[model samples]
Target: MLQSRRRLRSRIFVSFALFGLALTSLFAAATIYMRARLEDQLINNTLQREVENFVQFKQAHPEPDAPWKLSTFDAQIYSARKFANVPFAWQRYGTGVYDIRDFDENGKLRPYKLAVYKDDRYWAFLRLDVSTQRLSERQLITALGFAVLIFAGLSMLIGRWLSSRVMSPVSDLARRLRSLRRTGQFEPLAPNFADDEVGELAAALDDYAQRLTELVQRDREFNADVSHELRTPLAVIATTTELLLNAPDLSDKMRDRLKRMERASRQSTELIEALLLLSRAERSGPIDGETTDIARVCADVIDANRPHLGGRPVEVSLRVESPLAVNAPSSVVAVALNNLIGNAIKYTPQGEVVVRVQDGRVLVEDTGPGIKAEDAEKLFQRGVRGEGAVGKGAGLGLAIVRRLCELYGWGVGLRPREGGGAVATLDFQPRR
Candidate 1:
């Protein structure tokens, strides 16, 4: 978009420049042509008048033997045979009208309009010095050239100014849109803008923002209501399952089924809490004043999942280098970490799962048929499961983990372990 605007401004400037150039060039050419024509006419008229006056003076004086001298009308006379002092170019011309340029006695080039007259006795030639008129014409041409240059420069500046004025509102609109992304709030456009296309666009943007805000508000309210309503049934199921598991003389089969129900209920409650937190994070931000000990969280997650281990012969251990602390909601951290550890446990048929907290990262490593290269990234997407996935799942575990990480500015990644299986690492420093 920005590149397109720049091109638009450039096109406007070039158009103005070309227009100015063409107009100025046409005017300059016309001015120069008229000046040249007028100069020629004035010189020709002066030369003709001088030739007539010289002829009259000669006829009245009748001094054929007298030496040639400069005339009163800023001209010089020469006889046809007196070729000693005449210029070579003038001597070569026949008895016809001729315009010639030659150096004067002072070694400065000057224009001459020549006329020749023939009589029964001798031939008389008249030359008029038209250097002044030629100089004036040259000066006029130079001035016109300068005027064209000045006008062209001015046109360029005017084009630039006009483009800036035309694009100011658009640039402002773009800046406001960028700010809206950062702050999640719409800032009304200034009311003083001209009542034209830009003003209409600003009004349209404001209307869109209002409608979008209302839609987002409705969605947030709906998510909150749904999450709240789901908790009641989940709580009842969990409570009922716990009571059934503790019933005296309960059949083994019934107890096992109750345990599965309890686990499913717990998973549902966790998912609902995660969704609620995510919705809240979107509406406002990460919850404030919430912190968790990384080591304790990992230990609790591992212990909670031990019941599912049942006779899998998988060893789960937690290792903490120090008391690593994170400044984030415990539920957010728990959901992220539990997904990692739970996947590790669920995928590993008979190997060890190690949870380590070090260097501001929680590393969960497991020994299982390692993930396919293509599935490494796909695993984090909703409804995407790895090729080696074991248990039945909606494929929301890693997606939820990814969402929580993004909401709180944490980092999560999964990679294959060197020997075999996969390793998941969650970086918590960004949240802090």
Candidate 2:
């Protein structure tokens, strides 16, 4: 039996969600990297310009005895001796731009950009406070992290919605297919789906439905024709055998042979009728609703098969519990019970074949050669004969029994007996 393991919608949703998350994460990382590079370049250029301005001012003033006081918009200048008041980290920096953390006059940690210039006469150091820039960068990173999270969540929701939309038509098609099995009615599917893969699938299903409907129609017609054609000849044979048995001067051997012929003809007619009923039921649902007595049918089947027993010492017995009744045609019940009992009798050469009805189930047990564990189930299928089968049969008796049980919503099973032979049970309770 095939089992549905997963849904297409879930797979599609997860794929889209992962793809969106990866793209969003990559974009966020790239943005953060570019921002850091640009921030560093801006800080370096600002510090270099400040250093150049200080050099130009020194050359312009040329005051050897002037008080060393210089001010810029963004940076503070200090000589090597005065720069000692700055952080030790800043003083240790060479003649290059560097970012460092320092304590201000208020003893608060702050970020600063330091530019150092050394010459033969004096060493100059320029310090620019970048606490605000660092604070802004931290805020940007925090905001980007939250944005990425929010976007990822939105992508999941969007992916779920899109997957549902994409798979809706396929789901609808599946539901229609299931409905077809129950109702045997076909409706066009292409009109309900869009012009995509789903539409193509619907078109294919419609074509298959049309072809299957035609095939079934032809099969039913063929079965009906064959039933009609065969029943005429079987009726003549049954009538001729009945007439021959009625002759008063017939010998014992001739009478017994005629009786066997009559029994065979009757069985053939009953089988054809039952098979025709089954075929009709397949096309137009279960049409036989008449209730039948289980014990009566089993007794009739035993009497009908007595001729086939011939010289075999196999004894057949029927055990009925409380006169069980089932809602099915007498022919259908007879066909199923007859096959079970007939197989039991045919297989058991000398031992007893018992038919018992109890607890809404009919069990046929025999003392024949036991069935193989592996072949127990396979014997119920068409064209499959049990390994212990003794007589020449087309291997369709149990298959017909199974079909009747299925058509009437009953349950049938065959299992190996404890010591020998097999037990076939037919439960009247409808299979759910």
Candidate 3:
């Protein structure tokens, strides 16, 4: 049911997003068209108003149509013309009057703007220039700008609303399901105020919760079955070891063999302990919220490994900024630093291992031969070895370190230090 709801949500989200995009495009195109029409109307109305004003002004003062010979007038029209011939674009042309010019598709005159004046009289004469290219372009640009801003704002609003309307219940249900996993209680579904896909999602999640409960019950039984099977062998091994050690009389060779057997048993126990620690480290969830000083953890790890240094001269440098803090468990951090320092000591024959905290990171540098490029990828894997590593200890130290950092969402990296040798760096987020 949860999977079905997820599929449904994906479809709804895509549809709503596409709807917003389509509306935005349509709005932009419509605004452009409207702006063009509005500019054309404005030009026409201005021409008519200007022409009427000129006519009214001419009537208030008297100007009789009489014979007038002007340089721009023809002989036949000059006797009837009463005003000077004026050239104004986008207006009608006649003798002793202003005219406008326009472009026409069929080779015919198209009036672009009005130029008004009375015949043989100067009465409030004015030219009204209309360049469709200029005014229309400005109007179109302004409308387009407004459309873009409005559509962008609306798109954001609609997109957010749709997402919440469609997916908020699914998100809530997922949280509830997670809660059920962490705790065994199966609480009733929360109220879904929405009446769309979100409501359906909430109902589907309730069904999912029921199935999860059944699966968990089966898993518990399975775990018990496996644990019972493994317990028999472990008990036999422990009992047999006790019997062997309790035996009193024994030859030197037999005692030595027994001693070796005990050593092997002890090593096995240590390996198991390490494995359990590693598993716990891997299963560890996100870091704890408590603030911890990483500098102190590094110091503790360095101090602990000092005994194992075998008198090999090793220099420890602590370059941490005072009070280095992070929201993590001190033990987890200590483990990571312990592994790094241990490796540094293990790999280096006899040299200083510089431990420094710089830029919110702990770096362990050793003068040992740096890891090869091919081996670097495999270094963090369990039981894997680089070119020069010796010994039979399972290579789980670095692997454990990596898993711990991953569980805590910290960063760990290895690189060759300048001059010689390799450097292992662990970057952790510092507390604000």
For candidate 3, the TM-score is 0.40
* Model 1 whole-model lDDT (C-alpha atoms): 0.76
Give one clash count per candidate, in the order shown. 0, 0, 9
Maximum-lDDT candidate:
2
Q: What is the lDDT of residue 181 in candidate 3?
A: 74
Per-residue lDDT tens digits for candidate 1, residues 79-99, read 646655665666666677678
TM-score of every model?
A: 0.67, 0.69, 0.40
Task: For candidate 2, write residues 233-291 as lDDT tens digits.
Answer: 99999899889888999999998888778767877787887888777775223256656
Candidate 2: which stretches are off by over 4 Å? 1-98, 117-123, 153-203, 233-266, 277-290, 430-432
Candidate 1's error at 252, in angstroms?
A: 12
lDDT of 3: 0.64
lDDT tens digits, residue span 135-191, model 3: 666877787788778777877887787777566556776787688779877776635
By lDDT rank, best first, the candidates go: 2, 1, 3
- Candidate 3: pairs in clash: 82-120, 83-120, 89-100, 89-101, 90-100, 90-101, 90-112, 90-113, 91-100
What do the candidate models score in CA lDDT, each in turn? Answer: 0.76, 0.77, 0.64
Give the winner by TM-score: 2
